[model samples]
Target: MKDTNHPLPVIVEQAELTLAGLQTTMSLAHNTTMQLWQTFGPLKKSIHNKSNGGSYSVQCYADNFMSIPFTPETKFVKWAAVAVFNEDDIPKELEVLKIPKGKWAVFSYKGTISDFGKFAQYVYQEWLPSSGYQLDHRPHYEFMASDYLGPNHPDAQEEVWIPIV
Candidate 1:
């Protein structure tokens, strides 16, 4: 795993992502995220989007509670799919991220979806402060590195990637 304290240059590339329970029908976004932590441990994954409007937007939260529906079937489905970004590519949203190319700090966490909230807290309260990095405004994401049948799946692991200056 890459050290969270060190900065690295990343290539911005568009990546296709499929989220099983990111939709409104699902009531356990936080729970699902925690389950992911329990399964694979923890790791950071990259996300991306296209310069055009048809791309999906990526989001990271301080908590596992996602007010937005995770799927496209809902009326509030704000994103089509999650994407990982590489440096030099267009920002991963219909609207621009409004940031210049640079290095970013990466972190990894894994476990059950229910534990995701704690992991997020660690990033904001613990990791970011001690890592000597400033948070960038670029869109970050939770990459599903391992297969998770559902939010309750015991064998799920996810990697979270964030952009930092």
Candidate 2:
């Protein structure tokens, strides 16, 4: 059944990445998060704060990202992710990915981490289902690139990339 009320975004099929480096694993609910916020506060966002319990199996460095299954409904406390890209024709210091070729659903979001989750909800709840592509049970992640001068920069841009089949 086509959902006339929900509109889907254009889906791009490309195998640009295969793995990603998750520099940090954090949840806003935990008290230990202060340390992380102090260090990487510039790039951070609030994901769904679920009391039902959720855990993310994330790994740093795309090269070491092993394929694993994950539950979609299990909510996670979101955080801003910054991409470590290839510089000077060479991979960046956090070089950790070698994508053999896979599908990706890319979306762009601007501003602070405050509205990050809302953007995600727009994708997962609204975009994915209407687009006709099912979610790939893999380690999905976001890409942090663009003019991010620091946490204070309001124009900071981010690319949210989810692995798709």
Lowest lDDT sum, 10 consecutive residues, model 1, at 20-29
Give the alpha carbon lDDT tens digit for every residue of 42-145 in model 1: 12122333222122223543332234433322222222232234234432322222223445554444456666666666676666777677666554665553
TM match of model 1 to true structure: 0.44
List model 2 lDDT by residue over 1-165, tens digit each: 433432333356654432222245443444233454354343222222211122122322232222332243323433322322332232232223444346767666566666665666677767776676776644565444433444345676655566666
lDDT, each prediction: 0.41, 0.44
RMSD of each: 11.3, 10.7
Report lDDT (Cα) of residue 126, candidate 2.
74
State each candidate's clash count. Answer: 42, 10
Error of 1 at 48 (Å): 17
